[model samples]
Target: MASIAMLVFGGNAHAEGGSYNVDDASVVGAGKCQLESWLREWSHGSNGLYAVPACGAGPVEFGVTLNTGHGVYGPGVNPSIKWQLRNGDDKGIGVAVATAATWIHGRQDDAQAYVATTFGIDDARRLMVALNAGVDRIHGESTHSLLGLGMDVALTTRWTLLVERMWTHRTITDQGGIRLAFGESSLDLVVGSERSPHPSHWINLGWNAAF
Candidate 1:
């Protein structure tokens, strides 16, 4: 369970400047909750801290994140919701729709709405692929479309690997990470790069707990 949460929200650390990233299509089991926290440091000496607590009820999941950072956009609150449309199985795929709203200090609020799909691959179903496309709206600004692709591969009983690429307008970001699980908790270490005319590197360390 902890490993799953890391896979779902780990790449969120790469989100900077109000850009959206791909989110997982799966949810925690009903009545279950997950807590995730991460610290991100960029090559330019800026850093941020993020914390998210999510709960699943029936076929829907709800989450909110507290973002405190030293960047163009300061502190913020991000709330999100995802509804499971289908559950993945040996013979079928999974789908979900998610939306997130962001309110930043002294800046225009932003929102994103997207649809995501997941497919189980390989004979053991240990490999999964996800794709998402969505629209982002910034208050008093033009809307833009976003696209993302991601994969999760199980390396062992207690290890998993993640890779993802996301595009929003002219900016493209890529992320890769490995998750280590111990009992009901996991740790994720991720490295990512972004191209917004110039290249910048980001490193993230995340901890996830399931309860």
Candidate 2:
């Protein structure tokens, strides 16, 4: 019952931008239910789940994120699914690969797929950053390309931070935002803002739980 509720409210069931409410509930497991309600108002309005194997044999990590936003399809919202892989030194030097798909629903429902790669950097302290670039294809129209860059900084062992910006030739589509994470698995706070050239800007705040 609780898991189902979190999935509905925390998954950006009704969002308009590429970001989701701050406390992106999906990141937490099943033990932090107490913080869900408040988190609905404090996050970036995007949900992402990631897994990193205990850096051992060869420094490999992978993760995924679901983005809820509007796109080439129409006024309806779309879901963007992504898979990422990283390989390099424990200090954070290496290459990262990512591929994502978005399904747009409505009049003419269109789907898009994107693939990108990034270079990683790690100061090893509390700050880290990565860069990515890729191309996007819209089923029937010309293939639209994109160049994106982002950074992640861990303020502490339990607090993670994110900043991302992307540019494209199309109007009313460029976007970016920031995210902050706190706690381990059950409690957290997130704040973020995003914009599009149509030109609208939105702010989000959320608190989340996983029990």
Output the number of the TM-score-best candidate. 1
Off by over 4 Å in 1: 1-20, 89-91, 106-108
Q: Report, for every candidate in turn, its global Cα lDDT versus the true structure.
A: 0.68, 0.31
Candidate 2 regions exceeding 4 Å error are 1-89, 106-122, 171-183, 186-197, 206-211
Displacement of residue 21 (Cα, Å) in model 1 is 3.6
Candidate 1: residue 95 lDDT (0-100): 83
lDDT of 2 by residue, 1-211 (tens): 0111011112211001113211110121112212222222324333333111111112221222222332211223333323324333244443433333333343323333333333335446344443434554544666565544445466666555655454443522222334344452323233433243333333334344323
Cα lDDT of model 1 by residue, 1-211, tens digit: 1111121122331111111245656776699988877787878788777787888999898887777766635477777888888876344687878887776775537777787777877868688777878877667878888777888788998888888788765677787888888998888888888777666788888888889
User: For candidate 2, which ten residues in a row score worst on lDDT?
Assistant: 1-10
Task: Indicate the TM-score of model 1.
Answer: 0.86
Candidate 1, position 201, lDDT: 80
